[model samples]
Target: MDVPIKATPKQFYDVFCNKTHYVSNVCPDKVKSVVLQEGNWGTEGSIISWTYAF
Candidate 1:
């Protein structure tokens, strides 16, 4: 797969803010969810961790 692909600045920013790529990149059988612990809109030093299993 030598396809040349790139993400624009806006695209990169969206991925950073929201894990759009994280969910889409994972397998279809994987489980996913988003927990809101006081800061769902993101903030300074907000932490986001993801776990994948089948």
Candidate 2:
């Protein structure tokens, strides 16, 4: 995939680490689906996992 050259790659590269409040609840305090976890900053030997069930 080709990313837009003028896009905010630096900020967009983040996994919502800077802003967490904007994230909504998964199940209103019960069951949840999406998850966000923090690891190391930047893309140096770091990995992010995303999963969903259908």
Candidate 3:
């Protein structure tokens, strides 16, 4: 899913790629946790895991 936002690419990366900024700040009730499984955040081929409730 592609989302168009008001923020620039850097700003988008800075927020969404900062691990739990989206989950913690935006929708904490829906997401439990986010784990960087294999690679680094904001990097290509990075593996991310999400734990959500409801």
Top lDDT model: 3
Candidate 2 residue-wise lDDT, 1-54, digit = tens: 563543376654442454322223332343223334545434344454444343
Better of 2 and 3 by TM-score: 3
Task: Give each model's whole-structure lDDT.
Answer: 0.53, 0.40, 0.71
TM-score of each: 0.34, 0.23, 0.55
Off by over 4 Å in 2: 1-39, 52-54
C-alpha RMSD of candidate 1: 4.7
Query: Clashing pairs in model 1?
Result: none
What 10-residue stretch in candidate 3 is worst by lDDT? 18-27
* Tens-digit per-residue lDDT, 1-54, candidate 1: 353437787876776576543543543356364444444545655555555565
For model 3, how does the per-residue alpha-carbon lDDT over 1-54 read when each residue is reduced to its tens digit? 675677778876677766542655566787777878887776888888888888
TM-score of 3: 0.55
Cα-based lDDT at residue 43, candidate 3: 81
Best-performing candidate as measured by TM-score: 3
Determine which window of 10 residues in candidate 2 has minimal summed lDDT.
Answer: 19-28
What does candidate 2 score on TM? Answer: 0.23
Better of 2 and 3 by lDDT: 3
